[model samples]
Target: MSGRGRKIVWGLVLAFISFYAFLEHDVRGRFAARQSVEPAVIVPNKALAPVMAMGFHNLWADFSLLNAQVFFANPEYRGRIEKGMIFREMIELATTLDPSYKVAYFFGHFALSSYWNNWGVRQANEILKLGWKNNFDDYRFPQYIGFNYYLNSENKNEIVKWFRIALRYPEAPRRLIWTIDRMLRGADTTNHIHAESMCAMCEDAKEKEQKRYFCERCETYTALIALNDLRLAYLRDKGRPIGSLGDLTAAGYIDKIPVCPNGCNWLFTADGAITSSSLAESSTDVRGVP
Candidate 1:
């Protein structure tokens, strides 16, 4: 209301308008954009936002990598591992934060499927969903989906569709990709049948062996099928209350239990070779079985 007060107010209003204009000016547009904020831009090499959001320790995954190295170096304790659920949870939490962490995706799949059994299926599916959400155009997600169907859900159609999508990727492994392409080009074919065909499609004996390995190695339902057959053998021969691999073998059904690669141990072969994914060897009772 007073002269001096009114002048001060007018001066402040002008300064405020100038600041707004400065912010909106073309010269400032680039700096205002997200790309200009280096930290905000999603860097492929770094832990992406989702991975950061999960509150998982990067050190844990790193430790897992180290443990894998130890495993490769001295694979003496293949049978003993505990805390499988925890390992899976960490992997799920990590990939949930960074879906593109391919190593985590793959190792997570292996840790869960091979060691923890189908306990990893839900985590694998979660990873697949995250991949789909973040990078749908990437065929890797669909390939994972197909893998899950083949392993967990046993949905042949869904498996075929996803395999087809994976085959479209430029970086896909040609032999496997072409095998999937051929299978998807057909209908009503089971995975076992598809796997046999894939083996036959191989031109070289070594390549055929590799294909056979893929078919038997966690990628197929071999583990689950073997476990089922072993269970049935127990039920049929010795009844459900049976105990020990020796018992199964004595019953003439021991061959039903599947075999892992050499150096893999039989920590618990009473019912089957139930490996502990997250448990250390010191924690398991590996004394009784021969």
Candidate 2:
């Protein structure tokens, strides 16, 4: 191999490396370009306001990967690693890598929300902030904010406000918009029983003896619903005796709220066991309101 031959070979290698780099950069640029045109993508522009720009910036995405041991440590297992923690850190890191990655943001938000009940609210707010920073227009961010506020803060006003904002988005449905409006105006009828029944369905367990406990547990919610009806009746009549609850026919608040389709009697049992068993054997319609 003479010196000239080696020099020529080295030049050829350099040219190949340069071509490869150019191709790689071009492909990445095109991908980024496509992402930019996507409506869902939260791309940040240079013109963004300082505070908002912070949210859109890729700063905190890879918080865990950069700190390997901090993420891998699990005293519970000698050598076993905490995969959830590692995944969480990686997700955050990905978001940092690409602040515009709404998927990463959502994934991180969900993980955090699971770890902390109030996380949904915080994540919603964070995403909203990011959207605002990017001057991005989307209903999901605000909707989530409102949802978190309602679910975690119990702040009715805030929930209403955010949900209303969500309505402005083209994707938001009209029915939800109306419901939010009614709730905000306090025109929404309170159905304690229905709400309770749904909740019981969510938490009640079935261990044979405890089987159909949720179905029976609905009675409590039903009782509350009746109580709510009574309250409304007293309010509307403005002097009606509050001693007993009136039937739905007489209650002016709602016009025939949904009942359990199971044909199960929701009335109080003579023995007053106050169990969901009455409806359990009657083909529980799980979707029943009362």
Candidate 3:
């Protein structure tokens, strides 16, 4: 409208046009650079993932698994991780995020089916094996492995081995309450199984505090196992049972005693066994909270 005002407006318009041009040029450069590069997974390493999560490891694991699920569900990306990175194997990043995550192993079949690819089947089994190893009582883990075998192999023994593991629990075909009841009755490895159950609860928990709580319960059972190992080692070396729990620390079997998450004391049985004082026949009660 006025001479000075008009000049200022014109100057601003020129500057805006120059900035747009620079931005367009930068975009083109990046597009060209990535044109030859294959898309890659943005996941972090399994061991270092806990550090990245900073205590919300289960949440991160859920995010990573969901990311992979969405990616694979895409019709364009289905059966392959990416076009450019054809040879790159998709590591199960979710498991790395929370190795104790129970369902991530079961979901391996999403890729394991013949529709995904041959490699998908193999990779799925690899993921399932981790689950099976950590969760021996879970029928689904071994059952999934058996399904994978049916997909790729005619090995009946391998198939039976997994199926037998699955059938060990009569409650496998029933509701979860039944399974939990049977486990509580007298399963020899009840503590380990309960620890896995806690991990499963952590996997499905909606809140951060709840997830962390279940995970801590799982860790208590893990500590029980470690402390027992120390007890056995002390017995072997000293040629007698430990008079007390402190002998393991004094003998350098462990740097110190593991604290129970329930704020209870760790017990040293007369037979040189360790257990949490909170639960009955054993101390590895992973089901309760403070």
Best by TM-score: 3
Q: Which residue pairs show backbone clashes in model 1?
A: 50-97, 51-97, 51-98, 81-279, 82-278, 82-279
The C-alpha stretches of model 2 lying farther than 4 A from their native spots are 1-93, 174-290
- Cand. 2 TM to true fold: 0.37
User: Which 10-residue window of candidate 1 scores lowest in summed lDDT?
Assistant: 38-47
Taking all chains together, the TM-score of candidate 3 against the true structure is: 0.44
> Any idea what lDDT model 2 has?
0.45
Model 1 has an lDDT value of 0.49
The best candidate by lDDT is 3
How far is each candidate from the true structure, as Cα RMSD in Å? 18.2, 16.0, 19.6
Candidate 1 lDDT by residue in tens digits, 126-186: 6666756766666667777776666675556577556655655666665665455344424
Question: TM-score for every candidate vs. truth?
Answer: 0.36, 0.37, 0.44
Cα error of candidate 1 at position 258, Å: 41
